[model samples]
Structures are given as C-alpha cells and as structure tokens.
Target: MAKSKRNVVTHGLSGLIGDLLVFRQRAGKTIVANRPKPSVKPPTTAMLKVRGMFRKAVIYATNIIQDLTRKAEYEKAAKNGQSAFNVAFADYLKGPEIEEDLSFANYTGQTGQKLVASIIDNFRVASVNFSIRDAGGDLIESGEAEQSEDGLDWVYTTTVDNPSFAGGVVIVKAYDQPGNETLVQVMV
Candidate 1:
C-alpha cells in the first residue's frame, strides 16, 4: 500500500483469477494440458432471421386479437350508456402509476449526516420506505417515510447514523396501498 497527499494506492489484480487443466492417464503414460471447456457460440444470422420472423408474427397476431377484444368490450359498454371518461377511469384503475422522479440529497453520506429523498409519482403514494445496505448486502438502516400534505410529492429526511452507509447501496421502495410496490436501487 502507498499513500499520497490526497489518496492511497494499492497494487493488486483487479479481477477474478482461476486455473483449469485437462489430464489423461494411459496404461503406462500420462498426459496433461491446459485445455478449457469449449464455450457455446452465438446465434447465426439465419437463426436470428427465423426467430425475428416468428416473433413478429406472434406479436402482431396477439396485438390484433387484443385490440379487437378491447374494441368489442368498449362497444358493448357504449351500447350500455357508459361514458368515455368511465372507460378511461376503468383502464386507469389497473395499477398505481410509476414514481418517475426520485431524487436524493447526499447520496454518499457519513455518520449523523442528513439524507433527504424527494419522490414524485402519478397517483397518491400510500407509503415509502428507505434502506441502506453494506457492500456485503447486510442491511444497515431502514424505516418508513413521511409524505407531504397533498401526497403527490413524498419527502424522506433522516439522519444516517450508520458508518457503513457512506458507500453502500440505497434502496427506495414506494407503494400506493393497492398492493403495488415500486422499487429503485442506487449505489451511494
């Protein structure tokens, strides 16, 4: 190890090291060689072309069938006096919207440092949870979050007291109380 004015340097291999060999023994002789197992080759151009043809055919047919089914359902609903907004609302009730914008302050934090997370989702978020994990995947700290008044934006501010959280992984799990959970992971 060597230390400089601003940083420390360590000299070592940067990746995994391994060794493998093949050997064969005869009646009165032995032979050895550094022979590795053969690896599988990639798909050829013809294979890809055939795969793409079948893939496109299947997807096109499935999309057309689904479109027809949805159209028929909508037509039946319209004949029953359902409004356009009702159809849209019915489609929107499938699941909670994704949280598009998730920002964090002080991603690389020290002990007792304040960490803030701001979230913006499409619908009302029921709850949010944050977790910090060490390099070995051991949880350092975790807890529920606090939401804003209107619930469109969520804010989670807490003191990072664990010293192992400075360069660990940060996990954000947000839910909309509809049994749907949105997860995002980031390296701190």
Candidate 2:
C-alpha cells in the first residue's frame, strides 16, 4: 500500500475539514476533533485595588518605622555621650586648680629642711632667703636660694652661687632658727 500525504489548512476564524481518509491514514483510526470552549475570567479591579493599597501601606509604614528607629538611636547615643563627658568633666574639676605646697618644721638631720610655702609661677622659682640667728642675734646660719613655686620647698639651684645655711643650729639659739626669714620675693 502507498503511503498518502496529509495537508492541514485553516480559512478565516473557523473552518473544518472532514475526511475519513486523512484520519485513517494519519492516526490509523477514526477520531473526533472539537474546539475547546472559551473560559470565563474574574474581574481584576477589586483584587488589584486591594493589592495596591496594601503595598502602599507597607511601604509607608516601613519608611516611618525606619525613620523613627534612626532618630531614637541618635538620641540614645547623644545622651550616652553627654553623660560620659559630664562624668569626665566632674572628675577633672575634682583636683586642685592650683598646686600648693606642703611644709614641715624641724625636719631631722644636721641639715635643716626647707619647706615650700608658695608658688610664684608654674615653673619659675622665687627669690627666697633664710637666716638662722643665735639667742645673741648672731647670724648662725644664712642662705640665699631660689625655691620651687611653693616658697617653702627648696630645690637645688642651677647657679653655683647658692648660699648655704650652717649645718646645725644649737638648741640654745633655736629660737632664731626660722626668725626674720623672707620666704619669697618675686621680681617684677
């Protein structure tokens, strides 16, 4: 048997070919063909409106929440920083504004100890003099020296011309030990 050629064509919107020979030759059997009916679809208006509204609401709410979070975080950080600075400043002020001197009289040893009484400046020393006199008013010990800012305290002078006080003053003349002392004299 010779194989037959099949042709399929359509004209206009709808057309049908009826030939038992085509069906038998192509599929080897009799077949019925039918066009599917059009399906009905729901309207998109309500669904689209609902989706758009929810999307806009979510976007707006997200932006508002983010802004609020950022502002709150900034406020918290500023409060923390301010508190820290306050604490630090309070600590800073707790110390003495001007450094002062500590003095002691009758410090032990043959050499008399000089206690600083005042400060001239932050670094410069003040011209100071000390004299030890006996009960007879005789100069038993004399010294001219520059002391640390606090006049009572004495530091070694860079100038070798620093005067020396007698190593020891006799107890009988001790009444004159610190008498007539010019503790500090600042040069203008």
RMSD of 2: 37.4
- Candidates in order: C-alpha RMSD to true structure: 23.4, 37.4
lDDT assessment of candidate 2: 0.34
Off by over 4 Å in 2: 1-104, 107-109, 119-126, 149-152, 155-188
lDDT of each: 0.55, 0.34
TM-score of 1: 0.43
Error of 1 at 77 (Å): 22
> Which candidate tops lDDT?
1
List clashing residue pairs in candidate 2: 115-152, 115-153, 116-152, 116-153, 117-151, 117-152, 118-150, 118-151, 119-149
* Candidate 2 TM-score, C-alpha based: 0.22
